[model samples]
Target: MNNLATPGMLTAVWISLIVYMGVILYFVVRGARLTTNMADYATGTFQFSPAAIGLSLAAGMTSAATFIINPGFIAYYGISAFLSMAVFLPIGAIISLIVFSKRFRKIGSAVNAKTIAQWVGIRYNSASFRLYMAFLSILHLTFIVLIAVGLTQVLSRALNVDALPALSGIVIFTFGYMMFGGANSLVYTNMIQALLKVVVAVVLLFSGYQLFTNADAGFFQQLQQIDPKLTAAFNTDSPLYRDFFEVVICQLIVGVAIVCQPHIITRSLLLKDDKGMNRFLWVAVILLILFFTVVFTGLYARVLFPDLMVAGKPLPLDAVMSAYVTTYFSPVVSLFLVVGLLASGVATLESLIQSISTTITTDIIAAFAPNVIGKQQLFVNRLVIAVMAAVTIAMSYQQLVNPDLSVGILAQNGVYASFSAAFVPLLFGMFLKNVPVQAAFSASVAAVVAHFGIYYGRLTPYMETGTRNPGIAAALAILISLLVGAVVLVLYRQTKKEVAV
Candidate 1:
């Protein structure tokens, strides 16, 4: 299909785009005026209410990755992925609230940390750690930019616009505005965008159910029409079925990456205290459950359009929802999906960009140019955002060129997200009872090495199958980090004892 949109559909898309963009812009403006100082620019002056922080965290976690790829997850894995997400996400949020925020808030406040890398620098007294952390900071910035580019593609496809100019305009306009207002704009605007995401997700949910009109037939009937294996809970004979459980289990572990996620962690720094995080933990957990559960919409797509899924074959689950959206939903609804899509992509990208800028400005830039201030600092930040935008845009183009990179591949690229390796040790050192700095350093290095080794070694089942998931590898890597951290801690303690004697 050249473009799935009709002339009538295009008009509806335009109307939704104008209204949503305007609403987003208002929040951006409001956030800018409210930002009075550098503090306000980063961490909302440590004054984010539970509501704002909760929304930012939820929105950051649930990106277009959730909207686009998650449904595909459901289409691919049936009910199992959903089950794991339900069980796993709450564990992540509780850890974030009960374990992380209080400790992080104290450290962030004491050191006046602007970014995770800056936080690491303060916590560890290591310039090398800061350098590695900055690289990871830019790493996420690259991914978010790729997300932005993907959002551009989805938006262009749905709205019936040529993608090239659309992406160029989006990159320039959004990046500049984001650099101008800094994190001040990001938090409030993200809160607003995040709120809109709720509306959009709700719309997708009901509309999806609406599209799945045959409640009487439901899973079995749909399976009968398509391959019985489409909803097959498990069958030893089928490779896909046997592998699905392992894949979802891996997803659950990668869900732990939520712990190290800097964008979400940045929200922790914004909160007033642990109370702010604990107060809204359940709400955030619910939001994620809703987000993951909504992935079932892809199942609805698979069922409702049996022809789309071939007789013997399980359709390319990744493309099924986009196809369904074009055919099944109203033009207006698809537009809202696009809006949610845009919000999700931009939200993730914006948060990453902010984190990167914060690191560069607070750690690297400030280290080199301590006297930098006002418009100049802002200019430096803008330069960082522009570079990030350009690089990610390139990554996006590469993904498009490499048609082999599916939703799962792109989403799983998150295994490489810096939080797991760079921030994890520092945060663990602060929160864990007896973690030594030396241990933190070793864990930090070991996790990175282990992640790359397990992944590239072709040792994991995911590698044997040709599909890749960094989630399980990430979990192993983190565990390795902890184990190494512990050993290093013990050794350091013993050496100190001998020195004292």
Candidate 2:
């Protein structure tokens, strides 16, 4: 029953995969038709309803980690994981998006900024700054690897295929199509992915309701029986959730800063009108809250496999949910869940590829080679994507074969570091006008140093343990960058006042 080995089931999954790919290809082709230039490819030329764009935003933001991989952590840990990932993180990100979206969109539109690097570079009037930021954006390739690995784990298990082949297929197909679609196709595809995820999210969240039937030892009590720490708000046994500070405070700050990613912030630029933006935000927020709560399903996995073993072998943290789906659900439902998880990965993967490749081509390459025409720019964009795909395959295969406490760790390290550097520049650019570019530049440099320094130096007691959590380093970096930028801004203002006198 757990294996999902029937020929019928395998056939159904294959057919579903083919249909999904066909539909996606059709949209990509249509979107590519509308995309005549780099700007059109980056932000899309078509007019999209805010509701659709908002759903697209929600899909892009909630990647495989949200629906698939993070659940594995919750399955291994417990309520504390839920608190950090599901509750605090979402609250911070949503609040950040609400506060930052309008301002970011306004400035991005005024300057006609297509990528985050362009926004930062143009705002500071530094082409070198743009190149540096674009280089930093390459860090998002880690997220691309994370999604590839997640989808591979889910699909390979569901279809009983090898991880390498599944991973290769996923990377090639998704990235191959992504080279053509850009924002135009991405919006339509993401909207559909989001809709599918909404269905799967509802099913998974309600799946565990039966566990509550026992009065003397209900669901929470069952978790308490296995490991008393599982029911606790702070699981000291887990490195990531040592206490309230790491789980709540650290995660809150990380969540707030996480919205600074290029794929995430640039989502607002897709909306052509304010009415659409408002509707998009409302739909995205409500659905995202639902999608995030899917982490609670991890607790159900714990109940089924208390020891976290699928067979003779121990279940790796990343493999927990995929194993759970294979074992718990009927074959038909398993196939559906498999596609849902695939959607989760593709949604974010498309956005990352489009954003990062566009930044490299338009902001970095084109900035230096001003004579490069639009047709050549598009060619270079596709070429960059191909190079990125190759890099992703190499990194993803390494993590798949010999992971360091889950691919999520690798992802967090790169993602947190990039966004940590970006936060200061982005925040300063948005709210504070007339501030010295040196402050933004210096703040970015400090963030990179502080983040990597704290992480590698093992500066915090939380990171002294065998399992290192990148969230600590990222949270600290955000604070340090803010402080440095604030000091610089204040000093500059004082100098201006003195000169006036």
Query: Who wins the lDDT comparison?
Result: 2
Model 1 backbone overlap count: 0
Worst 10 residues of 2 by lDDT: 1-10
lDDT of 2 by residue, 42-158 (tens): 999889889889899899999999888999999988999999999998889999989888888999989989888999988989888889999999999999999989998898877
Q: Candidate 1: where is the Cα deviation over 4 Å? A: 2-4, 34-38, 45-48, 84-90, 93-97, 208-216, 232-245, 273-275, 305-318, 414-417
Q: After superposition, how far is residue 60 of candidate 1 from its true place, in Å?
A: 1.7
| RMSD in order of candidates | 3.4, 1.2
Please give the lDDT score at residue 54 for candidate 2: 89
CA lDDT, every prediction? Answer: 0.65, 0.90
Candidate 1, residue 143: Cα displacement in angstroms equals 2.9
Q: What is the lDDT of residue 302 in candidate 1?
A: 62
Local distance difference test, candidate 2: 0.90
Q: What digit string (tens of lDDT, one per residue) describes model 1 on residues 1-501? A: 224478877887777778877876777787778665456667664356787767777777777666765566556555544444444554554455456666766788788776777777667777777767766665565456446545666766776677566677677667767776666667777777777778777876786554446666655566556665556554333222345544455444455555566676657777666666566565566676676556667667666665555435544544555555665666666666777767876776677667767677766776778798765776677787778778766766666545343544554554354556864576565677655567787887887888778776866665566555566567677777778887888898899899999
Question: Runs in model 2 with CA error above 4 Å?
Answer: none
Query: For candidate 2, what is the TM-score?
Result: 0.98
| Sliding window of 10 residues with minimal summed lDDT for model 1 | 233-242
